[model samples]
Target: MELSFLSSPQIFFTVFTLAVSVFLYIFIYHQTNRRKTNYPPGNFGWPIIGETYEFLYGNSEKFIGDRMKKYSPKVFKTKVYGEPTAVLCGVAGHKFITANEEKLFRVWRPHSLQKLFRAPFLPNASASIPRETMVNVTRAPGFIKTEALIGYLGKMDTMIQQHFNLHWEGKQKVQAYELMHRMTATLSSRFFLGFEENDPRIEKFARLSDGMTVGLHSFPINIPGTVFYRAKKAADAMRMEVQQLIMEKRAAMSSGIQTQDILSHMILSSNPAAGRFKSEKEIATLSSALVVSGFTTPATALAIIMKYLAERPDIYDKIRAEQMEISSSKKLGELLNWEDIQKMKYTWHTSLEVMRIIPPFQGGFREALRDFTYEGYTIPKGWKVYWSVTTTNKNPECFPEPEKLSPTRFETPPPYTFVPFGGGLRVCPGKEYSRLVMLIFLHNLVKKFKWEVLAPNENMIGTVIPMPGKGFPILLQPLST
Candidate 1:
């Protein structure tokens, strides 16, 4: 009876249909996943923790270079910063992320950064401060207008002049890191917040900034003794203090007092894109973000540039001549204008090369919004993408004699390769602003003095923003007027 039942036409038909359906389903699933799950060739390190120790505990370049040697150079898979990371190496990798942003990827701050600089300073899970306001206040016609920037040239020139008069003019010996940091603080405090050259805010802000910057690259451990904890506390305090300053500025502005600073302008401006003026709290947060991003980097870079210039007289002479020519064009007691800054091409290139060899800002991080393929390897959705400047900055193919310093290399560097300020929509909004300040400072520095680094072979200690290991003690020889 059982055999007869199995042999029935109805039973046979059902059995055949089920088998075909199963076969087709398996075939389709395998075909789809074969394309989707073609993950890049690299290990995730260990079980839950991944390769976090090897990645963070040693020289990052060696860690990355070793992986590229073991796997493919273009892209590789590993877990870092508590996420599955696709480290994009070389010029192609840098270009890929810059070109494909918003399509396959979006700006992603590390969770550590998010926890450290929460809302107002940075919008939750956002890549940067409000895009429109940051752009408008930085470069747009309505806000700190192009002409307004021209006005700032005079102010900056005076500040640099005063800075030298106070610090660099009479001194035979100085520490590059401390001096550059103070110079940066002087400009940032005065220009960003309208603090005077002698204001105490510089010291306070410096303290707050130090605490936060030290923890920027630390793991997000919130224990009382950890660096991350101190960073978070400092960041929180900075937010409160900045907001207080904003409140004071807002109250002052309401009474028809004259105020001409970045913070004041940010307060006065309305957001055309967002269709409303930013609140004081929002403005405070954005201002802090700008100061934090734009502040320390220029200082570190200036110190590095000084070290290079101190070591290379040919480079310094070219810059010295450029500044002298510009100064000759100006009348006695006359301040430098925007056009003078434009003529500093050689000086600018020299600075650019220094940045390339030792980038202060490094490259940024992004999140993959969806599954994407690059070089025939799949980057799964939600995986973090690391686009690096260090990898491309030292490529012998793009830069001939990668270890050698050559400012002329800037003339021939291929696109998306020499990214000191990074590239694409997420590029440093402070690029123009930084250029203005750095050039002005350099103009004064190289013109008035030729310095020699006492420790000519100072090694860098930090990675995120590389600082001279020895603080770059230098002997300053003043130029006769």
Candidate 2:
């Protein structure tokens, strides 16, 4: 009789007791461990999501910079993009990240991209391509291609004139961004694929490349109809176009046509034994990446430089005077060779300063593959590391009076302090090409037109790439003959 009475509520009582015991154990364990180790000081907002909301809302850069000012030059921890990212600030950290230590860090590749853009040839939905392949495809070829590019530039004067005549005429305040996109596309097509100015395929490829960046800031979800989906489709189309160009160039080369475009150079290159040439697919991928990466950078840079010039009439006057002095003896169609570009050292300096102040890739992310220590803090493995270009560029210690746009600042800054092209093995290979294009275009524009900004106040929007909020509108007045 006693046993039966006890069994009625016994099961409920036992379950309640177990739950209480587990909660107390977890609470005690957490409190004890929290006091044991010294973690980097940061605001961990909540469990799981952490400080991701701040970053998603666009305050990450300002917040990180503010924290750096308060914390000094050292390693600190904060959550970003749903992960714990170690924020490295100041000059020393910049050196550490861009130096040989970069080998120890992994470039951040989003899972969404990996899933969507599967191996190019394989249909294995779950298979991921090697990281090296991605790097090779995206890496800009360095000074090895300098001589080839210079030769191409020397022979492309007529093409440049043709583009200007076609695009800049009968225009009532054309969009600066649109003009830049067209210019870069046309010039790049001629240089890379040997396409004539009127090639319809070349024009289509340029349009697709320019549109690829539109949806980059959207959510990762690739619904039935979304920007990401459209971008991927565009990329696929561009890839096919590139392949066709490569095949056509290869055929031409085999038949001894000996063209002087980038395609010809790539196909003709070989190791000492006349073997080890790039495959058709490899060549296509590399060429495609070059067009996509190369055009966007110079186009955006030109737009920004023009915007600055428009805002400050005094600066515009100086630039115009310089350009006129350079063009005094040379004719309008005369090719501006590389040596000529290099001779304009002041212009180069000015461009460098602009990039330092407003770099295209504002923040770069790297993941730690192993635990590392920086400034006495142990950065655990699997944490993301970030270097803020905008913040570091503005650091007064490295750049004295960093706010001022003085190109002379480069004369005394510390090494690795101003890395607009980045550093180490991964530095942009297209640096020479970009510099050449910018100088020639700027010199010609200043000589031909006087321009003014359409709107000065609404040009401060920031995203992955910073651009004028109102699309860099400008009113162009043709120069007197």
Alpha-carbon lDDT, every model: 0.78, 0.67
- For model 2, give the 10-residue run with minimal summed lDDT: 135-144
TM-score of 1: 0.86
Q: Per-residue lDDT tens digits of candidate 1, residues 83-146?
A: 8889999889888888887888877666667676544433343334445456767665332455
lDDT of 2 by residue, 16-86 (tens): 89989878876775575366346565544444455654654464457677677665557667765556778
Candidate 1, which ten residues in sequence have the lowest lDDT sum? 120-129
Candidate 2 pairs with clashing backbones: none
Over 4 Å off, model 2: 1-39, 43-60, 69-73, 111-144, 156-158, 216-218, 250-256, 260-285, 460-462
lDDT of 1: 0.78
- Compare the candidates by TM-score and give the number of the best one: 1
